[model samples]
Target chain A: MTYCVGLKLDRGLVFASDTRTNAGLDNISTFKKLQVWEAPGDRVITLLSSGNLAITQAVISLLNEQIRSSADTSRTLMTVETMFQAARLIGSAVREVRKIDGEALEANADNFSVTFILGGQIKGEEPRLFQVYSAGNFIEVGEDTPYLQIGEHKYGKPILDRVTRTDMRLGEAAKLVLLSFDSTLRSNLSVGMPMDLLLYNADSFTADRQLRIEKDDPYFQKLSQDWSDALRDSFASMDELEV
Target chain B: MTYCVGLKLDRGLVFASDTRTNAGLDNISTFKKLQVWEAPGDRVITLLSSGNLAITQAVISLLNEQIRSSADTSRTLMTVETMFQAARLIGSAVREVRKIDGEALEANADNFSVTFILGGQIKGEEPRLFQVYSAGNFIEVGEDTPYLQIGEHKYGKPILDRVTRTDMRLGEAAKLVLLSFDSTLRSNLSVGMPMDLLLYNADSFTADRQLRIEKDDPYFQKLSQDWSDALRDSFASMDELEV
Candidate 1:
């Protein structure tokens, strides 16, 4: 299990993902689930993945391999003309990984589940976010629903549903995603730190604002403690149930 | 889908359940999921159910018939001498319903799924809460986890995980349960009002504080609005992410 969220606000895109992976309770490990692709002034793409780590890593490696080989520059993330095309490239990679591993996984009664949230800006396009399914289909975030979440999403979703908006400032969106992650972390053991956060200012085409929030990072620690205290205070202040 | 929660506090017990039932997106209707069985000063038992409306209703009807027939008093809720016994009786009723419907439902590729949270007091015992599974097995709320939730539980669980405690007051527990319900209501269409709430003071053996919170109920409306506003205010007050 994992918890990753991407918010597409008017000012920019904010992404966060926990680095915890477990194959049963005893086989837990930390592995970064956030991947970034940047081509200086051309494109800046971020991918947050959840589900089978092998499959996600395989798909990501294939994409990176394509970029490294540069045999088909037009089809790679660095040269994709639009975010939609980049998402398609990712979907294709996911399907390719499935074709290679899905059958063996099915035979073992293991799910080949993998999902990704891909968001970024291409040179000539406005910033966009998409939730790419294992089936190689994808859906872009709509104005009404400006965020996409993958993995262990429910515990953190209410806050996002209530507070996220397209017009929210980049800094506020970042804070919102952190709070969402905080909720998930408290309730679920499968999602743990350190967390990877990426804040992309629209049209920047650079991955300069990425941060890794370790378990003891002061800001994350303070934010989580403060949020918990605030919730308790709010709950204490609510009017008593009359009935 | 449904949402029901039970809290066991030092002062008493609190239970809440939403009433909406749906077979699919198009077939939605109102149906009560909270049922109370009391022997006045002898015992007070409340059951909040979710999953397979027909199965839950069947279980409840069987229990009610058992109480009415009086043929085997030992097997009825009114005759149960302890909260544990009451839970077992309810579990038995569940298994009985499964025996009658399980095969037919499975043949149609339907799940005979039903789960329940039962809470109350029987005269000589302390207030108790149990989560009854479809298998007719159950687990009581322990000191460490003073609450149990069933159906669409994750969305509302963070608050309960944060604020609930054995020492919390009945009023605060009531508020927490409502807050939990509020979160579920906002995120899930399948769990909606009107909601039934029951607050039982320890050793009282009577459910005099039961309330039905209708969609337009003034207090519920105000609480929901205030909670949303408070959450937004909290989010606004949080420090901005530096990275």
Candidate 2:
């Protein structure tokens, strides 16, 4: 299981992913699920994946492979003209992985499920965020819906739903994403940290701030503590059930 | 989809279940998932069901039928010697439902899944809580683990994890459970309002405080407001990424 979130605010895009991956209680491992495609000032694309590790790794490899070949492949995330086209290229990569690995996984009684949140900007285009489904179809985050989450999403959703809107500042949005992740990490064992956080400032067309937040990182630790305290105080202040 | 949580505290037990049921995005109806089988001063047993509504209803019907014929049968929830025996009776009821309806549901590609959280106490026995699975096997909540959740559980898990401990008071535990439900309801549209809340005081041998919280209830409205405000404030106070 995994938890990843992408928020495309008016100021920029914020992406966060947990590093925990588990096949069972015994076979837990850390796998960085965020991949960055940067071509300096030309384009910056970040991919946050959650689902089968093999499938996501394959998708990333295929993207990198295309970037390496650079001959017959006229379409790559770095060369794509628009975020929409880049999303299509990613969808194709996901479909390619499904074509190669779906059947054997089905035979073993496992559903072929993989999903991704692809968000970033091209040199000429504005920052955009998309949630690509297991079927390879995708939806862009609109003005009304500025954030997307995949994997173990529900535990952290209430805070996002109540606190996030389309016009939040980049720093505020980043804090919300981390707080949301913090909520999920506290509750769920499947989602562990040393989180990969990427904050891109719009029109800068570069990865402005990318930080790996560890479990004991002061900011995150404080966020977790303060959030817990706030929740308790909020709960206490509510009118007690008269029954 | 539904959200239900049951907590076993030193003082007693708390059980809460949402009433919304949806077959798809277009079809949603309100149906109570909380059921009580109480002989007042002698015993007070509450059952919260999640998963296939038909199967759960069948199981409840079977239990009720047994209660009607208690004059002939030597065992029922009321006559059960221990809370463990009460769990087995509930499991047996689930298995009886599977025996009747499992195969046909499989023909439609639906899995035979129904889970139950049964809690409370008989006059002579200590209070206990059990999570009865689809296979009719159940596990009792140990002292180390004080709570259990079934059905769309993840979204609301963080608050419960952070707030619940072995030494928590019964009233405090009840408040936290409500906050947990609020978190889940905000995140997932499938789980919704008109929730069933039951809190049993320890050794009371009967349930005296049960609540049906509707969407517009004053206390719930206030709690939801405070939770959102508290979350936003906490997010704002967290330090920004130094990068």
Candidate 3:
């Protein structure tokens, strides 16, 4: 019941995540799914998560614990010189969470689940993006595939498939992601308001554009309204099947 | 897997279904998913199905048998007085199939699943559409809800949400259906080429337009190509998020 999308474009990376999570319809709550680890000019890493909140929280807390513990942890994400190593650190953290809670979650018939979109710069390397799956394995964003999405992904997939590419501008991509999220939120009840959006400029090593869109945010309201009008206009313009 | 969409517009109805069905990745085949039962100017009932091939085929076979015995059998789709009765007949047919094959399928862990989009006109009634679920119960389309889609539905849902309304022109609605199907076919391997598309004009009690679009069909190819381009163009045209 979440929709989070990360785009790796020529400019840098764009991340968007809806804040709604629910155990059931009546148990709905808003929780920010984007976590930023900023060492300012040195490194800036953002983590966007989906799936079971418990598992994702465990993984994030464990990673933060490592960052706090002596700062000399060999495979720590902040200390890692390359994006690939940061990804490995995330995978290791996921596996560590599984080791502690996987069996208990299975006992309750809740299959241990966690998926993440990890994107940022790590001092020495260029900004990169990766999607880590439930099995703790991961894949990087290639030029041909410039985006990654998790949670209620299908409702938002068509837009991404049709529009995104390597040469896409980060700003345009950010709007597309919001539009995609808007469509999903309209169709699905599980993904709701109060979304977190972040735009990172490659090699800037600083989160340049970040916005928290609440339920009544003016920009999102306009974007959704514009989309509806555009769709209607486009549909009206297409030649009909003569019946 | 399959993708079938049925739209109930003010002027008439539109139904579209993909032809692909797969037992596995390597065992994919083309099987027509749209079934039409028409008695000239009397009734024109089109049923678009998705889910287990065997179960749906069984339902169709039952209806076909009834039609074949129309001379003796009083209950047939073409002879039905109301769209409601027609839905019940289809539901009864579904339950009949489940009565015969539900347990063995369950034993094999194959969920007894099949859903259908039934839309058309019976002489006495206005154009109506219904979505029949696995349990054999069905819900009729209303003015408030103008469209119903089954199977791999999410990939194509955004456009429908944005554009479809009670006041849309039949032509515009039909084009929207095609775009929705195009989006679905692009993203999911289970939904594929050679689609069955039928458009029923109100009060005609017969199909006014129908086309079977194949992979090499010129219009379809053009539509698919144009849609992707239209999407990219829309993305570029939208004002970028100022970051």
Provide per-model DockQ scores: 0.80, 0.61, 0.66
Q: What does the lDDT come to for candidate 2?
A: 0.86
Evaluate model 3: give its lDDT: 0.86
State which docking tier applies to candidate 3.
medium
Instruction: Please list all clashing residue pairs in model 1, or write none if there are none.
Output: none
Residues A79-142, model 2: lDDT tens digits: 7899899889889999999999999999999887899999999987789899898888899988
Better of 2 and 3 by DockQ: 3
Interface RMSD of each: 1.0, 1.9, 1.9
DockQ-sorted candidate list, best first: 1, 3, 2
For each candidate, give the TM-score of chain B. 0.96, 0.96, 0.95
Per-residue error for A23 in candidate 3, Å, reads 1.0
TM-scores of all predicted structures: 0.97, 0.93, 0.96
Q: Give the candidates in order of lDDT, highest first.
A: 1, 3, 2
Across residues B1-243, which tens digit of lDDT does each residue of candidate 1 receive?
Answer: 999998888999999999999988999999889899887888889999999988998999998888899566456888778888888888899999989999999999999899999988988899989999999999998888888899999999999988887888787788888889889998899998999989899988788999898899887788889988888998889898887
Q: Which ten residues in a row have the lowest lDDT in candidate 2 chain A?
A: A234-243
Tens-place lDDT per residue, model 3, A16-83, is: 99999999999999999999988889888999999999999999998888888894646677788887
Worst 10 residues of 3 chain B by lDDT: B229-238
By summed lDDT, the worst window of 10 consecutive residues in model 3 chain A runs over A234-243
What tens digits encode model 1's per-residue C-alpha lDDT throughout A73-152? 45788777899999999999999999999999999999889999999998888999999998989999988888899999
lDDT at position A146, candidate 2 = 78
